[model samples]
Structure formats: structure tokens, C-alpha cells
Target: MSGANKVQKREADAEPVPGLFTLVLHTHLPWLAHHGRWPVGEEWLYQSWSACYLPLVRVLRTLAAENRRHLITLGVTPVVAAQLDDPYCLQGMQHWLANWQLRAVEAATMRTASGASPASEPKALRQFGSREHTEAERELAEFDALWRHGASPALRELLDGEVIELLGGPLAHPFQPLLNPRLREFALREGLADAAHRFAHSPTGIWAPECAYSPGMEAGYADAGVSHFMVDGPSLHGDTALGRPVGDSGVVAFGRDLQVSYRVWSPKSGYPGHAAYRDFHTYDHATGLKPARVTGRAVPSEEKAPYDPARADAAVDVHVADFVETVRQRLSAESARIGRPAHVVAAFDTELFGHWWYEGPVWLERVLRALPAAGVRVGTLSDAIADGFVGSPVELPPSSWGSGKDWQVWSGEQVADLVQLNSEVVDTALSTVDKALARGGSLDAPTPRDFVADQILRETLLTVSSDWPFMVSKDSAADYARYRAHLHAHATREISAALASGRDDHAQRLAEGWNRADGLFGALDARRLPGR
Candidate 1:
């Protein structure tokens, strides 16, 4: 049978396969508007936008056009949603896209060719430029047409069409394990609300920031109307064939199938390391574009072979077949072991596609199509639950998808200072907001515009973001992480102090200035700040 006919037969089969598979992609980035550029700031946001978001959306739209549904589960944190829809970021992204096209032109014209080390590669650089220029034009046109308004419109299109399931999390991606309970609840409530405001649909699932879980968080998830969430496989003790209920709550916790997930990405190896794939680290200095492939493990970046699109495409085909066979065997084995149809889930960061792994999106699109053709069932987490891919209740312990599958990454000795800073600043801000509300005799009323309390809460939330601690622990842009944490902590302190001192005018000015930078989650109100 033809490929299309095979897919139709598989979809039409009333008796399902022995198991099911679901892919989850968690999308997140800290608030970067009004932050620095280049080394670390808006540049991170723009690069992800042009590379990952643009192409990933294209792939989804293509699949949707073919009437595909529940292709994947997409968890977009409210912090990222805010940046995608913000006016400043929207305008900045346009300039970034246009600049990329210009850079491509410069590369093709040899206006900025480097003179160091390589003399036999001018032709290769020009070819790379031509390819990039074409890609940039396509991305720019897509941006101007579908994404000009912000991410919401296009995202709503996918959500409304049932092309994907959207997952929502707290306003800022805070590590809920160490966060104050009240603040945690408040952030989650506002976050779901922000999602509803933007997408016109509130998500019933969340990515839960780092897959971090503390035991009673299930109750919190239940309270926020979250029906399910993701956790690492080790948290489920490796029995990851189905979703498990947490501590008597109706909410389900799905664990990533590390056996299958690590096939695509692991600490030491994955498909991205294949010799024919594009090299992510090696760049041509002349045009600031990567031009090499992973020629070999021992090969130096300068000596790596020039990337060939056809070679990488062939590699994608091979990797897709391998992944399909892996999932098939896994599902078959797990079903026999459990004496029932099994469920397998693999989750990763959305930015991994086309951002970190250059050919990731293509591989993803092919895999989604290939799985069903191979008689393997695929669906979202919600679909899996509805289809009864659930098991006995599990009393999950304190865990996160971090280095040690524990809280050490965010709360370890390496970040003890950040943990302490978060605790002290959160306490001070909460108390200050409480007193301010009490004095107003309007503790339950909506917060007024320019209220010092709003900005105080904003900065406080930003101060405790999970990104800072993760960056510090991993030493990836550690200085930028420290700078951001301290910056927000300082803002929270200054604003809270101004309000406490009855310097209303000064506090308002400070709040306004800060809002010009971090003013997201407009629906957030001081009255919603839960008191300890």
C-alpha cells in the first residue's frame, strides 16, 4: 500500500495497537524584554523565535492541513506567552528577522569574508548564505503574515483546530518545590488566567517548570483545574507504561519514558551527534552562521566537513526509522510485561528543535507521520488518559528532572545563596503588600494601575525564576543569571520600601519605570497576593 493508504488503515483500525505514544514539548524563556542584547538577552529570544518557533509552527500547520489532530502536547508557560504578545518584543523580533536577511545577503556577496585559516571554503560560505537567505525570506514572510500580531493568534489557531493540546504553567516559571505555597498558588492562578486571556482557552495541563514536584502539589494542581502534569521517569520509579494518580487525587502524573526519550537526546549521545547532521557549535565567523557538520567526535570545529543538506536529510530518514522501531519494540515489550496495552511518553524542550539541534523539526515532523504508518498509536496526554492509559495511585516523592532527579540543582549548595535570596525577598514583598492592602482598607478590591504593589509582585516573581538557579548550577551564562536575579531582587526591595515609607509618588515612578520593562500579566492584582 502507499504511505497515505497505510496511515489511513492504521487510523481506521478499531482494535488499537498494543500501546500508545505521546510527545510533549515544553516551551519557556525568562522575561527578556528591556534586558540586554547580544551575549544574553533579547538575542536569545529572537534566535529561538527565528529558528524554533517559526519552523515548528510551520510543521504543525502542514500536518494540520492534512487533518492531523493531537499530534503533540505543547506546554507554553505564561512568561513566554507574555513575551510573544508584548508590543516591544513583537517590534524587536521584526527587526531581528530583517537583520538576519541582510546578514545572509552580506554572506552571499562576500562583503564580510574572514581571512583567517581557511582558504578553500569561500564557495561553501556563499552557498550557505544563499540557503540562509531563502530561509530568512520564508521566515520573514511567515512572521509578517501569521505572527505579526503576536503568538496568540497563530497559537489559538492550532488550539482551536485541535492540532495540538496547549499546556499552561505559572506566570513566571518558578521552582515550585521551594516557593512559598501562597505565592505558588497565586502565580498559577494568574498564569492560567493569562493564558485564557491570550488564547481564549485555559489549559488543563501544565509543564510544572523543570518537572519539579513536591508531594502535595497534586492538591494544588487539582485546585487550579489541572487534570494532568509531566514528571521525569525516575520520579515514577521507572514503571512508565501509564499515567499514575498522585496521592488519592484525581489529577494524573505522566512520566517521560527515558528509554525512548534518551534515544533522541541524552547526556553523551543522541541522533543530533550523528556525523551527517549539522554541527550546532561550529560557526563561520565571517557571517555568524554554522557551516559544518558533526564530521566525527574527535574532529576539531575548524576541520569539520561543510554541512550538506542532502546528507542531513538522508540521516533524518535513518533516524526516524530507528526511533519508530525503538518505540514499537518498547510498546510491544511493555504491553507483554504489564499484560495490557501500554503507554509511552517522550518529552523535551520545544527549543531543542531547530534551535539546538538544527534538523530537529524535520525529524519531528517525519516521526509523527512515520509512527502511525508503522501501526503505532499516537496521541496527547489527555487522549492517553481518556483512552484509559492510567494505572494505580502513586505516592510520588519530592523530585525534579534535574541532574540527580532531586531538588539539588535548584536548592543545592551551589545555589544556596539564590535560595536564601528568594526566601528573604519573597517574605519581605509579601509582608509589604499585606500592610499596603490593610492600610487601603481594600484588601479585596482590584489593584489600581501604577500600584507599587503590582510591580513589587512582578519583580518578586522574576527574582525567583527557576532559570537563574539552573543557569548557575549548569554554569551556562552564570553571570547573566546572577545579574538578573540581583536586579529583580533590588527592584522588589526598592519598590516595597517606597510603598512602606508612604512615598507614593516616588513608588509610583519606580513602578512605572519597572513596568516599562517587566509589565507582563496585566491581570495580576495585589489583592490576589495570598498572605502567609
Candidate 2:
């Protein structure tokens, strides 16, 4: 069938007896390059690149090649984009791809060594050449081939081709709901501009960090030229008939379909944890690498076996089919109930595809292909809004995809110290800005706009990221999280103090230090904010 006919047929099949379904995917990761390498930071970047970014780009490229017009919208935050385009990140990803190839070679060598002289080796070593071992070698080879090429061209191609509508968010994916209004406003505006400059496409929508929403955030979106943003279904009070405009701002808020999104990846349970998928934790102590099955229940670290991609691929296919069916059923049912087509938006963190859930890319490809086959149409959020679906009029409660779909994950008792620190530092920076501005250029040489901007940038970065306390609460690299929080906090505090003291040398030094550490948000100029 012709591609357009196929899409029309799918849309016809998905027409709810009565509502519309929209699918929005969020793509974000913090700036990890030049920070740390193997153990945690850079490894995060490399793994996600291997599993998600590269595969996603390939999927879009293939669809475009076939003239399929698979309309999918992706939100890539400025922090994530900065890292993707960073020289350090580019070089590190290349090294990471090369290292995977080396691992494949090593796995093959180990298998051959064990097979050539089985009796001469220890009894425990005989299993090294078993079927599972051979499968591991094959999977690594496949993985290496997929990522050996650089990711830039593929990423650029998607953006340039308009295969996917790009969405931008605040620098560092900050939880803007709780942030200082002026600072938040500055972050959002600059972030969108930065995205436009980098991707060569001005984004009309934003993926609010964490899908977190607040009443007045729409005003900020409007200021940034964003006409729409997304939130979870519950945030819209369980209605998805159409997007609701926030206040007088000409922006639409698209709520995510929690039910459908959870089918793919949820906080507590999802397809990624299936026994057949690759396990994220529990790597081999000898190689310091991940090599085991999810196995449903956690296995002892010592007993975990090498990763078997073949097994994982089987699981991906099954899950993909199930996911496609879920989408089909939801869309069909919603359309019938509403007496009009309704959108079923299934939103998720892009990192889940390749970084945490190793087989995510395979599932993504299968789902994209299956959706059309199952008579379900694909589209971007912009397409849905442009089509005239209006959301119900309801006051959205403040919420995020965090624990309990609330803000506690970022501000709970476990993270009270960090939260309080963030609050105080932000207040101090604001106060300093007020004082400096009030003095009318008489505050000891007057803090340079860049100096003030740097302080705002530092405080903004420190306050915006939901990562700090998330790490602490989960106890996953708590020390690193705490250290980063303090690093940003101290910079905020010191810069405020230096400005308050009217010390030029100290202010310059502090600004330079903060700039050197967390410098991705160069686009943020606090002076640009009204009355600054």
C-alpha cells in the first residue's frame, strides 16, 4: 500500500468510537562529559548513546527514507544538547564505541581460548565456551557495529530533516515550578533560544523538566515563544480530550497518558525488568562491566552470568507487540467514548531506551513499525494541537513523575538539607541582584552583568536539576550528588557574598570558578530579565 494510504488506514482504525491519542517522548540527560568517566558520569553518557540516541536517530532516518512520515516529537533539553555537541562528549563517545569493539574482540578470544584446550583449563572455566558465551560475543559484535560510527551526523540529520519535531526545556532540566519566577523565566527563554541556534529549528513546545507543572509556568513558555508544553494525565485532572491553555498565555498543555506510558517503563515495574532483558546493575567484578539477565529477582553478584543479547532481543519483540496493542486499544476505546478522536499520549524518558533499559532501542523500532501495522497513527504534539483538540478547563495541581507523581522525591525529608540549601542559595543570589541593581551602579565598581549573570547561572543550575536529591534518596552515588549540590551551592553563596562585600577580585575569581565548573548555560543572561 502507498505510505499515505497506510497512515490513513491506521488513523481510521485508531479513530475512537467517540477521542484523539498523542505520543510524546522526552529526551534528556545532564551534562556528563568532562566531569567523570568510567565509574559513573561519562559512562552514563556513553551507555545512553549506545542504547538510545544512536538507535533513535537510525529509526527516524529509516522512516524518512521510506517517505513514511512517522510523526514523533522529541524534547531534547539544552543541558543534554550541550553535552551531545560538546567536543569532549564527541571524543568520549568515539572512544566508548571503540572500547565496545575491543570488548567484542576480547569475548571472541576468550571463547576460542576455552574451546581450543578444554581439558587443560580449570573445570569452572569450561563454561566459558558454552552457547551462552558464544551468544555474548555475537551481541557485542552487533552492538559495536551499531555504534562504531559517530552520532553527530545522525543527530544532525534528524533535526535538519525535520523527521522529528524538536522540543526544548530549561537549561539543566530544572524543576521550574518551585524555582524563582524571574530566574525560571530567564532559563526557559535562553534555553529555547539556545536550542534554536544549535538545531536550526525554533521549538514551539517544551518538555517541562520531570513533566512537572505549575499554574504560572505557561507565562514563561509564552515569553520564550513556546506555544505548548506537556504534563502527566493526572495533572490535567484525568482529561485528555484537548490541551488546555494556561491563563492568558497562548500555550497548550498536553498531558501524558500514564497508563500507556507505564506499559513501557514505570518507576516500580515495566517491560525492561522482564527476566529476559539485560540487567542494569550487577556487573562482572573481573571486567567491571554489566553482564547478566534481569532474572526477575535480583541474583547474587557473584552468580550473575555474562549478558546474552539474543535472549534480550526475544523479550523486546514480545514487549513491542504488547505495547503496540496497548496503544491501539487505548486509541480505539478513547475515540469511541468521546464520540470524537482522542489522543493517547504515551510519554517517557528517552534515557530509559538505551541507558537503563538495554534493549530499549529494539523495542522502540518494533513499536514504531507495529503501530502502523496495527492501525494506529503516529503524530507529534504540534500536530495534535494544530488539529483543534482543546483540553478541559481544570486547575492543574503541582506534580511530577517523581515518587507518588509529586514533588516529594525532590524535596522529601531525605533531601531536606539539599532542598533547603538550594532555596537559601537562590534567595541569596536574588537578594544580591536586588541590592546591586538598587545601588544604581555605585556598588563598588558595580557587579559586571556577566558576573551577575554567572551567579544566576550557577544558582539556576544548582536549583534546577532534580538529580541531586534523587541520587541521595535512591542511594545511587549519593556522595557524588551531594558533592555537586554543594559545589554549585558554594559558588552561589560565594558569589553573593563577594557581590555583597563589593570585592572586585573575589567576585571575578568566584565567577570564573563557577563558569569553569558548570558552564553550559552561557545563554542565560539574568540582566535580560525585566527590571534586572
Candidate 3:
């Protein structure tokens, strides 16, 4: 039989694959809008935006035009959405793209100015600057046409078309397990509200920050109106064949199938680590370009081979086929073992695709298109729930997607100081605000919140972000993380002191100063937020 006929035959012969397959991509970044550029701040945002978000949007739009639905489940945290829609960040991204093109042009000119021939230079190195220049130009055009105002319109288009299922999360991406109940609820409520404000539709599910779970979070999710959430597979005893209901809340927990997800990325062994793919760690400091491949382990940079896109494309094709078959066989096995339909949820960071893997977007586009032809039923988490992926009740343990599948990364001995610092700021902010609200009699009804109280809450939430401790423990951008944590903690302390000292003027000034830079949730009304 021909290829198309074989697909048709498989569709007829297979027992509907017994379930569904969904890929979940979590999009997040700490507030970096005004947090400096170069080396590691706003640059991180623009690079990812251009390299990942823009291209992914294009890929989805192409699929959407074909009426393809539920292509992926995308979770954009409120903090990330805030930055994308911020006027300042949007404008800065445009200039950054233009600068990229300019640098590429400079790279070409320098090549011509040099006395050496193209034969003397590595082909990839010789072409890297020009490739970047062209990419930058294309990105700028796309930005002007689609993202000039912000990412809201582009995102809303995808959501409305059902090309993507939107999953919202808490403000600042806080480590909810350690947060006070009052603040946790507030963040969830406000975070969903922020998504609604941006996309005109609230998400039914959330990609919980780090997938960190305490015992009673399901109740909080139910209260916040979340119908489902994604957690690491081990959270459900390594049995992730379905979205299991937690307690009696009607909220479902979908465990990521590590067997499938790790195929795309893992600490050791994955598609990106293949020698044919681009090496993310190597960079051209002069041009800010990457022009090498993962030649091998312990290979010096000078000896590393230049990146060849043709070779990478070939590798992508092979990996895409391998991944599809892996999912197919896994689903078939799970269905036979369980005597029912089985669902597989594969989740990963959004930046891993284009930013880290370079050819990730291409592989994703190909895989999404190929899975259906291979007899796999692809759908979103909601579609799965609607189609009966909800299974038996399961009690979840305290778990995270981090190393060891526990909270050690955020709460371990290495990060004890950060954990203590987070606790201190959270307590101070809650106490100061609760007392002030009681004194003003606002605890009983809607009343105007003071600027100091508002700033304190914002600082406390920012200070408690999980990124700080993770960065500190991993030693990646540790200094910046440390600086940011203490910066917010100090702000909370100063604001709380001003509120306690009865210096309203100084408090207002401090709030205003902080608001100028540290403000993210511009519409977060502190008075209306619920407290325990």
C-alpha cells in the first residue's frame, strides 16, 4: 500500500489508539522588562521571544489555517504575559531585532574587509553573521505586522481558533507550597483574571509553577475555578496514563509522561544533545552568534565542528519519527495493560525548542503534523477530560518536577538562606498588610488600599519567586538572582516600616519610587485581594 493508504488502513485497523496525546509547553520568565540588558536580563526575553515565540506563532498559524485544532497546550504565566504586553518591553524588542540585523550586516562587512579567503574560515562561522542578519530582519517584519502592539492579539487569535489551549498560572510564578494560603489564593485569582484581561478568555487549567504540590492545593485550584493541572509523573506514582481526580474537588491532575517527554529533553541523552544539532553553550562573543554543533563530550571549542543546518534537518526528521513511534507504542502498551483508553501528556519548557535546540520549532511542526497520520489521536488536556481521560481517584504526594522529584531544589540545605529569606518577607508583608487593613476596617468590605500596602504585597510576591532559589542552587545567574531576591526583600522591609511608623508621605514616596521599576501587576488591587 502507498503511504497515504497505509495511514488510512491503520486508522481503520487500530482501536482508536484508546486515548489521546497532548504536548504541553510552559512559557515563563521572571520580570525582566526594566531589569537591564546584555549578558542576562531583558536580552533573555527578546532572544526567546524572537527565536521561540514568534516562530512558534507562525507554525501554529500555518496549522490553524488548515483548521487544525488543539495543536498544543500553552501555559503563559501572568508575569510573562504582563511583560509581553508592557509598552516599554514591546518597543524595546523591536529595537533589539533591528540591532540584530545591524550586527549581522557588520559581520558580513568584516568578512569582506579581512584579507583571508572564505576557504580559510569555517563555513559555518563565515555564514553565521549573515544568517543572523537575515533572521533578525525577518523577525522585525513579523514583529511589526503581528506583535507591534503586543503579544495579546497574536495569542488571542490562536486561542480563539482553538489552535492552542491556554493554561494560566499565578502571578510572579511563586513557589505556592511555601506561600501562605491567603497569598496563594490571591495570586491564582489575580493571575487568571490577568489572562482574561489579555485574551478575553480565562483558562480552565494551569501549569502550576514547578508543578509544586502540597496536600490541599486541589481545593485552592477548585476555588480558583481551575479544572485541571499538570504535575510530574512521579506525583501520581509514575502512573500517568490519565488525568486523575484529586479528592472530591472535580479538579484533575495530569501527570507528564516522563517516558515520552524525556525523549525531547533530559539531563543526559535527548534529541538536542545529538552531535548533528547545534551546540547552545558555544557562542561568538564578538557577534553574539552561535555557530557550532555538539561535536562530542570533552571536545574543546576550537576543535568543535561548525553547525550544519542540512545535517540538523536530517536529524530532526529521524527524531520526529522516533518520537512518534515511542508515543504510539507507549499508548498501545498502556491501553492493553489498563484495559481502557490511556492518555499521554508530554510537557516541557517553551524555550527549549528554538532557543536551545535551534531546530526545535521545525521538529515540533513536523511531529504535530505526523502524529495523526500515524494513528495517534492528538488533543488538548480539556479535550482529553471531555473524552474520558479522567480516571480513578489518586492521593498525591508533595512533589515537584525538579531534581529528585521533590522540593529539595527550592527548600534544600543549599538554599536554606533563600528559603528563610522568603519566609521572613512573606510573614512581614502579610502581617503589616493584615494589621493595616483591620485598622482601616477594610477587612470587612471593599475599601481603598494604601500605596504602601500595595507595594509591600508586590515586593513580597516578587521576593518569593522560585527562580531565585533555583538559580542560586544551580549556580546559573546566581548573582542576579541573589540581587533580585534581596532587592525585593529590602523594598518590602522599607515599605512595611514606613507603613508602621505612620509616615504616610514617606511611604507614598517609597511606593511611587518602587512602582516606577518593580511594578508588574499594574491592576492588582490590594484591597480587593482576599486574605486568611
Candidate 4:
């Protein structure tokens, strides 16, 4: 057989037999508000809200409207959920949606005038009054009206309405495997509690931060009432089974199917990189914004023209149909092959929706609609587990979807200085906690030593996050990564100095400084854990 034919045959044959297909979307971003705003801060939050959140909610609502139980699982990290539920975020998202409507109108006006010559009396003016332009204006007007209402209430309504299964992860979306065990436990517990409080129900599953996994992490999840969580493909020894329990915790770990997941959003190559999609990196210098399709590899930014939503919307429909058909075929064939049902799980970062892939939300909605018509059932992780799909027992090797699927991206030599600082912070904080607890010191009360210890814990966790080094390695907002690392490192150093000197005044001042700079995690009390 020819190589192309063989490839086509393989693609046609790769279907899940006798199994369910699951889609898990991880929605998370670090605390960007109050930290950074313009070039890369609130804009990041608002762009994601416009592209991913609002659209996703719309899709779920549409499914609900049809009286169809379209089961899909979603992970909203504590930090991201906190920002989404905040009044500022709710207001900001409304304003952002309004601006999007204005931009769409502006695009429509520009397209209507495309035939006009600079010196002419405007032949395009007649085109602007045409039926198509009027319809475009009406669509934009409707779009603006839909999202003009507050996003928080809509989000809360989605959760309350059972449109999608909500999942939670550790506070700040830290890579848990590399975190200090005590701090990791605290973060996981607090994260679950925070989700329960905010959403009015405890999340039974977690999208482990970055899909990173380790052996003993299950105990923490089990203790925190998490019934199921997700890991990368390799973490489950290449098995695409659902609800595999780790240890005696009864917490099920679902491994992602690499083939299905990479089809939509891979690190090196994916559907989103297709030439038809909008180019994320290259933007027009004139407008200081992204306004072109990725025509081809050699197409330069200056040569690219303004984006046409009509053209992009058509592309989204094609991709969505392909995706839905792919899922349907895989599920049907897999069910027949396995004698029992089989599952194909596809997972991806939520930021890829609107923030990275401009028309992702459109694709998402179409896919949701297409799946039911194809006879494929969509389910959440908990639904799969509750149905009793126990996977084979296997020891998951250490893994992350970061560079090389190892710690190199986060703990690589490039960030050796920051890594060393993190190590020292963890060690010193552990030592201080151990010493204070051994001497009958009270964690509930505020003492000079206790305050310093708390500060050290907060700074240690902040500096130790894999996000800083990972961002630096990718060169996406490298300066912001460096600043965050330095800030946390400084806090670590000052606290260490105060502890070593046994000076109450200096310790208090250091704690105060750290608190003033960033104080979200200061409330964390790690002493409650056993043997602390």
C-alpha cells in the first residue's frame, strides 16, 4: 500500500470500541488581576472570558434548552474561579463583551467599504446600505445584548442548572508533585472547600494542575472528598481506561487519550494551527491588535489583512463537524470491539478557546450540537466512575505535559537560581514549623515566630510553582515570570534572615512586607496536618 493510503487506513481504523468518550476542559489562569493588567494582565482574563467562558456557557445552555443531558466535565481552578466570581471580573467581562460588539460592527463597516477608492465619492457607501451589512449589524447588536448581562450570574446559573460537571484543582494551580507535601495537602483541601463555598456544591473531580501526577497525591484528593481526577496518558501506562483507583483512597484517576487529545490541541501541532485560524503571535502594527488569518507559513504580518468573522465562522463549522464525527466513529467502533463500552478521553487547556484560538467557542458550540446527532454520548468524569468502569492497576510514572513531559521545563538548569531559592524556602519553612510545633507553639494564635512561619510558608509555595520556570522557558511573558520569582525569593530571604537572627522586630517587619506585597495564601495553616 502507498504511504498515504496506509496513513488513511490507520486513521479510519483508530476508533474506540465499546467505550464512552469524555471531554475534560481545564479552565485556569494565575492571579493576574492586581498583579498585571494592560499588555498581559486583565486583558488575558477578559479575552478568555469573551472567547471561552461566555461561549462555553452558551453551548451548555443551548444543550439544556433542547432538553438534552449533554454531559461534559470542566475544571475551574480556585484562583480562576475566584477571579470569575469577583465583582470586578463580572463588570469587566460585560464591558469587554460590549467592546467586542463594537469591533464586529467596525469590521462590518470596513468590509462594506472595501471597494471604495481613496479619491472617489465612496461607491462603498451604497454597499454599506445593503442587506448583508444590515444583517451583520443586527447580529452584532444581538450578540452585545446576550452578554451584556453579568457573567457571574450566568456562570452560577450554569453550575446550579447542572449544565456541566464542575471540577476543582489546587489553589493557584501549582504543580502538586513538586510542592512541599504539607503545603500541597493544605492547598488541595482549601481549594475544594473554596469551590464548595462558591459553587454551592463540592467538586467531586479535579483537573490536576497541568495534568501533572504523582503516586501519593491520591490520599490528599481522597481526604478532600474528590472522587475522581485526571492525569496525562503516560501516567496511566498507555491505558485509556476510566476510574482507576490509586492506593486505598477510593479516588479514581482518569488518564487522557493522547491520540484524541492531540487531534484538537497538541503542543507541536494541532487543528488550531491550521492556516485558516487566526495567527496568535503576529498582529497588525497599525491597530496594535490581531487582525489576520494564518494564510500560510511565508505570509508576513504586514501583508495580512483584517479578519472577516464570516470566513472564520465557516472554518469553525468545518472543524467542529470533523471533531464530532471523529468522536462518534471512535465511540461506536470501540463499543463493538471491547464487548463492553470503551471510552475516548480528550482534554485540553481552557485558554486555547478564545484567548489563543479566536473562534474556539464557535467550534465548541457546533461540536456539542453535532455529537448528539451522531449518537455519541458525552459524559463527565464522575458519571463515568459512577458507572463502574474500573481500570487495571498500574503504578503511574512521574509525568507532566510541560516540556519533555518531565520537570525540565519547571526545574531545568535555566531557572537554577530560582529552584535553589525555592528549595531553601521549603526547607527553612519546614524546619521552622517543626521546631515551633515541637515547642508547644500555637498555630491558631499570632506570635512573632508563628507570623514569620506563615509568611515563609506562603512565600515558599508561591516561589515553588512550576508556572514561573515554565513561562520563562516558553518565553511568553518571561519578564513577568522573572518578576514573580524575584518577588517571592525576596520574601523567602527576608523571612529566613529574621528566623536565623531570632529578632522579633525584624521578623515582624519581614512578615509585614511580605503581606503587603501579596497576601492571598497567608491564611493557610499547615500545622493542622498530621505529624506537622
Off by over 4 Å in 3: 1-16, 112-123, 439-446
Off by over 4 Å in 1: 1-16, 111-120, 442-450
Lowest lDDT block of 10, candidate 2:
111-120
Q: How accurate is candidate 2 locally (lDDT)?
A: 0.70
Which candidate number maximizes lDDT? 1
Listed in order, each prediction's TM-score against the native is: 0.96, 0.85, 0.94, 0.81
What are the RMSDs of all candidates, in order?
A: 2.1, 5.0, 3.0, 7.4
Which one wins by lDDT: 2 or 4?
A: 2
- TM-score order, best first, reads 1, 3, 2, 4
Question: Which parts of model 2 have CA positions greater than 4 angstroms off?
Answer: 1-21, 111-156, 247-250, 298-301, 304-307, 434-452
Worst 10 residues of 4 by lDDT: 115-124
Local accuracy of candidate 4 as per-residue lDDT tens digits, 231-302: 887777766655578867777788888877887888777777777787776643322245566766676664
**Ranking 2 against 3 by lDDT, winner:** 3
Candidate 3 per-residue C-alpha lDDT over 1-532 given as tens digits, one digit per residue, 9 for 90 to 100: 7654655565567555667999999999998877778688999999899889999998999878656789999999998898888898999898889888887776655543221222114444567666777888888889999998889999999998889999999999999998888899988998999999999989999999999999999999998899999999999999999899998888999999999999889878789988888888776555666677887767766566767788889999999999999999999999888889899999999999899888999999889877887889999999999999888888899999999999999999998998999888988888888887777754567556667788888888899999999998889999999999999999999988988898878988998999888888887867766867
- List model 2 lDDT by residue over 229-266, tens digit each: 88877877777656787766768888888778888777
Q: What lDDT score is found at residue 25 in candidate 2?
A: 72
Q: Relative to the true structure, how large is the alpha-carbon lDDT of every model?
A: 0.90, 0.70, 0.86, 0.68
Q: What order do you get sorting by lDDT, best first?
A: 1, 3, 2, 4
